[model samples]
Target: MKLPVWKEGLAYPQPSEMSYPGGMTRILAHDGRRDLLPFLHDCTITSHEGRLYLGWYNSTDAEICGSSLIRGRYSEDGGESWSEVFNVVGEIGSAEEHFVPASFFVHEGKLYSLITEMGGKNLSISLDLFQAPETSLDEWERVSVLSGGFLSNSSPIPMDTGDYIAGVWMPLKGDTPAFPAVLISQGADIAKPWRCSFLYDPLAPDAVKIRCPEITLIVQGSAVTAYVRNDEGKHGDLTCGPSFVFTSEDYGESWSKPARMTAMPVGNSKMFAGILSDGRRYLIYNNDQGYFKRGLLCMALSEPGEVEYTKVYKLFEDKAAELDNRVGVWFYPCACEQEGILYIACTLQEPDGVRSAVIARIPVDTI
Candidate 1:
């Protein structure tokens, strides 16, 4: 299969222009000091009980070296306006801790936030349940730590048999490098032990260098298809490579060997794939040639079990020539579908070195 070619202004369901009162596109949060590098990366948005919640990791001084914090904002009027940023987790300016928000999911009538804490070279992943105080969204408590893994931004999927499965990438004890895997839980209960199954081996002699694995799963009847991002292209080329696929027939208990998806050309970055309520499968990713030059953020459509995609939508294009060698444009988009809108939260970078967390409310009917 050949890689799908994306043309400009070819998006379906034509994207609406910025026409809201305060503007459809607004910066959710940013660093106060212009000298510091403010980074808001890999945000997750969820609509629960008639309210919208956006969560992401914020770093003012540096991207990964300094202290990072998990912050959140809420909008009562469907994202038209958001409240002040509230500390979701982490101690502000902690010298020894760097907290990063991973994902969000609601189970058993409670909202849960997943966070990854990085200290030194070790990474600890945990979950906290949000406790709404009487009528305030500012107050939230960290209940307990779930499993200790690495960074996972994919939402957990509830199976028909009542189990839940989530994708994660972490290194095992004594392993040289980490790789992508899945966590199977008995139900929505995070307190219970989760069975861990590594989808691919990182230390295998022939294994490629995999980083920041974003695993997206689509369930069709009894089969579950996983589309995983290969951050580092196979061999020495890192600019452009095919995403990998793993299919499971036994409810994720077993998976087929990883196979290259020649139809999908993904840069060494995060990509999202999920089946929406309208039965259309959508994939949002950077359509660039490879290796961190993420300028064109696009959305592609396909059937449930099909590998080829069409109806390509160019969401945003970064025009900063200075960012050519650096991480370009939009990256790390965490998306969810609500009502008729597909809400995506991602890190948008400007030419002046200002990075922010921006939200795009895309209508699904247009596609």
Candidate 2:
């Protein structure tokens, strides 16, 4: 089928702005330090009581401060307005806990917020759960913590009867360097312990680079996708690599082996995936995989079980011209779906040699 053209929306230089860059949307909140640390990572956006709630990580200093916990920011008037950014984990100055914010879901009228914490060998690495405020979007209470070292980039899937199935990133031990891992959790309450492991470790013949995992439980099917990079020899090198997909029937309990989505998994370094309002999948990351080459954000359509992909179109194929190497490049693509719209938020390696954030929106039907 000929996929519909995806009309890309405006990009934001800062989070909280009166309006977006292209004037197509409004910026809800800005971190104010555009040239310093970028705000939010592994972000999840959900609609509740007609307002949009965003839970993400505020990276004060990637190499120093670690991923600080940021609270939910709400917008009732669609994308026209936004609330002030709050902190999820109460005021704890310089706690030394790296919190990677993740998925949010509501079960039995209670809002559950999921985040990952990494505190080196001295600190515990696990998933932290918080309960949202009863009325106002002011405070979030700490509920529970899941044990594990590499519990990050989690996507929670709510089952039919109200139970939740969470797909977590589980780190593996090998010579492939350090990356995200894959884990699974199933329970009625948010505090219950769930099983976690590597989703797939298929032989790549070269290297295994899987990070930024996203899983979706859809109608008549189930699917999982992630951003992958082959930095075998180059540990921190960012280049377009390849993307892979796995299928499951029993609500993500067991996945159906791995399959390559991109034609070849050799050159690309990034391939961020998101399920659209129309069931089509969209991705944003580097496409070239070549050293120093620019990466383009793209969108595509896919059938849940089918291995072959279709409608690969570029959203932004421009090189990160303003990126500062000292601060790293503008990367890490994550998307959330709400009311038939896909909101994508990512970081830009700022010109001041720091990290900054940019967000954009697109209708699901447009893809």
Q: Give the TM-score of each candidate.
A: 0.82, 0.71
Best by lDDT: 1
Mind giving the per-residue lDDT tens digits that candidate 2 earns over 213-288? 3333232244343334433334446643444545555555565545444353223333345555554554454444
lDDT of 1 at 178: 59
* lDDT assessment of candidate 2: 0.50
Clash count for candidate 1 is: 3
Q: Each candidate's lDDT (Cα)?
A: 0.65, 0.50
User: How accurate locally is residue 353 in candidate 1, as Cα lDDT from 0 to 100?
Assistant: 61
- Clashing pairs for model 1 are 13-366, 239-290, 239-291
* lDDT of each residue in 186-226, candidate 1, tens digit only: 67566575677777667788876665566777666567777
Question: Against the correct fold, how does model 2 do in TM-score?
Answer: 0.71
Error of 2 at 56 (Å): 2.7
